[model samples]
Target: MTALDVPGIRQVGADAFTWLSAHRDAFALGEDALTEDGHVDATWKPLGELAQTCASVCAVTTPADPLHAPAAALLDFAWLQTGRGELFPRLQRLEPFATYPLEVYSVFASAGLRHPGYEAAAATTARTRGWRSVEQDPTRRLGVLKAERRSGIRRPERAAPLLRRTWLGGLPEPWTFERSSGYALTHVVFHLTDWGRAPAGLPAGLAAYLTHWLPSWLDTCLDAGLWDLGCELVVVAASLPEPPDPALLRDVWPRIARAQLPSGALEQQAPQDGADTEPDFLRCYHSTLMAAFAAARTVTRLPGADGPGRPPAHDGRHRHRGPGEHSEHRERRERSGPSGPRGEGVPG
Candidate 1:
């Protein structure tokens, strides 16, 4: 595939997964064939394919800086998954309930959340808990009902990024882009969608609120990046409905070009042995998404588009919210909590 340098998008290497297939024999030695409780056979199917894709992205994308530890966290997630064995299955088992934002990010990017198999897997969990639907807001709903037991649920995972950004204020840009603002927004949306499991569509009432409020979320991701260090988030956020500043793009492209390796391969160029830095996190996320996209392409054969897909279609007219709608809703969002309502899955 051609090298990609979009503001919010990154590319990985094509051969990074070879180690998985090559190492399968060691895993087979366990008791009772691959079906044993701890033994891993099924994990091989997607893990190997995913590795090659992740390795490619890690090999290609720009590294993260100090501020975007969360971004780097995403990259590292990918690196850890490159090998095949029980670890892959174990991680998969732990993915859903992972409270760590990085685990969430990794799971969101690489897991089969969108595939029917995932939906099926989660069905039992949802039925058992009787939490078929989650309503964070009255008007909007998210069907997180399909539950699966995931380990390592920690609230601190999300708190860390929020606190870091709250304290640090913004992150530095690692790579430049032609459409920085729009690109940054796209990454934020993608990150949220992949990691946060944002619902597919917003409710009508919440849609109105989001149209007005999302720009701020985009801004937060961008400005926060200046403090936290994940230019990818900022770049994706910057690349939203509004365009980015031309001068900013002109200044950043050279850094992106230089970030690439000599062979134009950009998967995990940084040593895996290094301490988990922001760059490492970015590589992890980049690799994971690259792997997911590659898997999506291989399985579905659809050319992938960047970002969280598109917002629901609008007629292009902005209407004022009816007075009956809670004006307090606006005020609460203005106070800086979650602005938009959770969405249900994308409609057929």
Candidate 2:
């Protein structure tokens, strides 16, 4: 496995997830943190999203991996405990519907973990409502649809228009690839295929867009050392209609690995004052979590026996990709009527 491995992509992924699992106190949302309305503090939102994505990515990977089951279970426990899944009573008023929770649910379904969140009527209702309300915003609506599909729910996708909206459709001329939008855009890509479960999830025009511009966007993020976003772009590349070249992530993986602290923490921002000023756990928990997940996902896609089941890599990197046949799936994605006529290429 080591011989076939690509340095930090695997090792750092394992270490970062380990740091998170061990240091649950610093990153996880507390039970009491929810407001009277059942809404968690905004502070935990990004961390929660990272946990959700990590749990999903961890779910399908090898069972023996240290981070796999534990991460998944922790997230499940947290979702149920937080009353986010309606496992318990909603102590406070409900937070207005956001598609973020659906992202977690979609990942959970893709990972095949059985949980009420996947089937809870409330959760489904929230997701369905979110999808309907976001008709004007295709990116968000597409994300919600992906969650529903990945959760094994059926969706008509578009209303009576007959031209169904793909995830990439309905964006402005200049791409919104900033941190928040980058995650949103990349996430939509992941959802397009449900994290590679359905390669056909990659629509024709979107695939064409990616084939032309992804390399530059990925390179820009890597050069900026935007480790978190870079990781997502890597996964986006991995989930392409065609098998991505092993060389795609070759340069950026090592740099992300290099950002890891001795404590297994992946720094979110530039180094702050000293250890004295900083707590044992720094503020970058979300980035670290996402970074690890990105690495694990990329490794599984990389060309090697270490992928998904040649042997128990046990590091989450050995997981296999879900089934995807480019030609057929792309056609289906095209037929769905998504990728709604964006002339400008990939966002800068």
The best candidate by lDDT is 2
| lDDT of each residue in 1-348, candidate 2, tens digit only | 321456667677778767776776554556544544434433345445655655556543665554465555556444443444442223212443545555554544454443453356534565455546654455556566656666566765552132134334444233334455555667677656766545676668767767555655565555555655666777787678775655555556677777677666775544434242322454666667767777666656655524342222323122332211224333433343323222222221
Error of 2 at 16 (Å): 0.8
- How many angstroms is residue 164 displaced in model 2 relative to the true structure, after the best TM-score fit? 8.5
Q: TM-score of each candidate? A: 0.31, 0.69
Residues 1-348 of candidate 1 have per-residue lDDT tens digits of 111323322322222122223232332223322343432323432333233233222222222211122222333343344321224344435543321222222333243222233334344333433433333221111112111222122111232233223111122221212123323333333333332223232123322433444334433332322212223333332323333323333223333333333333223333346343334322333333333232222211112322222211223221111111234323433554332212221100
Which residue runs does candidate 2 get wrong by more than 4 Å? 1-5, 31-34, 37-47, 64-70, 76-80, 83-120, 123-131, 134-136, 150-155, 159-167, 170-181, 271-282, 306-348
**Superposition TM-score, candidate 2 onto the true structure:** 0.69
| Whole-model lDDT values for every prediction | 0.29, 0.54
